[model samples]
Target: MSWFKQGLCFLPVFLVIWSSSTFIVTYLIALFRHDVDIIFPYISDTGANPPESCIFGLMTFISACAGTATIYARYKYVEKLSEDPKVVNPRLNKTAFLFGMLSCLGMCIVATFQETTVTVIHDIGALLFFVTGVLYIILQSVLSHRAYPFGSSMFVCRVRSGVAILAFLAFFPTVICAFFVTQTTLHRDKGDTDYPYHIASAVCEWIVAFSFICFFLTYIDDFKIFTLRVRVECKE
Candidate 1:
């Protein structure tokens, strides 16, 4: 394989690094500015202010674009892998692609609208991202398992399954804890009875976010074997 073909693997690697960096940089900036408590802060809280918010918006937008590219590539990869074509249903892949893009749209919304400033829109965006993102992965995991010993390995299927399972498990706590806590508990009084829920929500949110990241990391190896190209044809 050419070096160009080899470089394809970097796409997923970039997504992982860039996404994690966005969270870390925003978290550090929030910490330095004392925008949030030193203990586990909501990922949005880190980027709810001026400087970090700016970086957060830009970085996450790029992350969404990268995520879109990753899903499309995987969609094509599976399409090519199908021997009977029915062995892997095109509808399933298309559905996964749709959900994946919707998740990216959610991420874009989350990026463009600041949580503190536009709570409702931001929360809606977040809902789109998390719910659809998990659905996307779960669908992809099923596809991977179905493709096993052909387009994918048993190991890859297992890993994707594990990550999808973790994300699914963590998602409920993240949402449930957030549901129980009020703004007063999250931002104002740590002494409130709901404070523990606030912390648990933040912790679970981080796990879900990183689980999403880890899920994509599995793609790096698979992406290594193929090169993506665009073809244009004319009928004369």
Candidate 2:
């Protein structure tokens, strides 16, 4: 019933929406570049099963809905914050918001071009996305620690810290893998498949997968416990 509770309810919805948008945009880029066939078995053989355009378009729609939900949640959360008496760091929050927005923009631009043309701009955008992701992760780590009361919940603290560290470790491998994979795939037309490159690619793939698992497990556990607590508290 309180504004804080309302805002909390919206946080997950917002994250989901934001994540979906990124996924949709990425899907579109994959479709446009005709790389869909290489990555997807359903469409790899004939390039017909998923229907590049259709799949991307559907993903775009889904992403749009998610973006809308995120906007709604953010607006509500901001409104709730306005009622607080604490001095808000407008500068930091503004910087974070801008960084996040630019990151999304860069991601969308990169996705749009990943299919149509091979340009340095796309690469730059990809790099920007990587940098932005790192910044966001760091910001989140700091914010999470600042928000939670120290010593009030040791279990939660350890869990959060462990997740942060794992996520940080995962980022490096994933980013490196993404860069190498993009470069290698781009140069595939030139027929340059050295043994080390292949090995690097394989290692990168494994690292990326491991990093994703760490990230997913971290959030999944957090949310699962949070939801369980909510249910228990409600029943009581």
Candidate 3:
């Protein structure tokens, strides 16, 4: 099949796997909260629950699948270009492959290390993974422009760049909130300062929510560009 057709086939499959894995992990988190209520009646009153293990498991699985897809897509694109010799730039293809591989490895490490037992290590790992993942996506966006400047350039590029900047801006507040929350949790042996911790935690929550929204918007833009290419090709 043509490059356009191959892209079309991969696009929906990637979205389905990506979206479903995220949804399942989120769903499991909610389920875990309900289960916590049964274990300790006072826990609901305190409104404190441990992070769900299921989310981490789901994240690992999703990252693996995504990593495989990234490697495969890069290889396939390179192979296609090699066959035709005039189809696409080999250097751009190699860049995509390299970044994709890095993203996969980063996610795997982040997911493996994100545990409540090692809160500091987990947070640091998460921060590293988050930065790397964002960078990888940004690199892909840049490379897409290099490959097909006019055809790939779309509104999504602006949206993603803006969102990524916003995420960076919010990072400080999130880190500060995390610090206060950690301190409060550590003082648990002394007394309960849940209220202050709750406020700080809420801020962190908002930052995370914003980050996810930004990521989704970026992916949506990617899908739009992929679809446009397929449609344009079909018309010709």
Number of the top lDDT candidate: 1
TM-score-sorted candidate list, best first:
1, 3, 2
Q: Compose the digit string of candidate 3's lDDT tens values, residues 44-105.
A: 11222235454654555575566556455544643453454454566666665665565556
Which digits, one per residue and each the tens of the lDDT, describe model 1 over residues 150-221? 766898899999999999998999899999887632254667888898889889899999999999989988
Residue range with the least summed lDDT across 10 consecutive positions in model 3:
37-46
Provide the global lDDT of candidate 3 against the true structure: 0.47
Candidate 2: count of backbone clashes, pairs at least 3 residues apart or interchain: 1
TM-score of each: 0.94, 0.51, 0.55
Candidate 2 per-residue C-alpha lDDT over 1-236 given as tens digits, one digit per residue, 9 for 90 to 100: 34324323444444554454434444455567665423321111111223553444344344334433343333233333434424233344445455555555655555454333445676676556545644544454444344444211445445545654664665565445444443333223324434334445444433432332233233322332221122334554
What are the lDDT figures for the candidates, one per model? 0.89, 0.42, 0.47
C-alpha positional error of residue 188 in candidate 1 after TM-score superposition, expressed in Å:
5.3
Clashes of each: 0, 1, 0
User: In lDDT terms, how accurate is model 2?
Assistant: 0.42
Best prediction by TM-score:
1
Q: Please report how far candidate 1 places residue 53 from its true position, in Å.
A: 0.3
Runs in model 1 deviating more than 4 A are 1-7, 184-189, 234-236
RMSD of each: 2.0, 9.6, 9.0
lDDT score, candidate 1 = 0.89
Candidate 3: residue 222 lDDT (0-100): 35
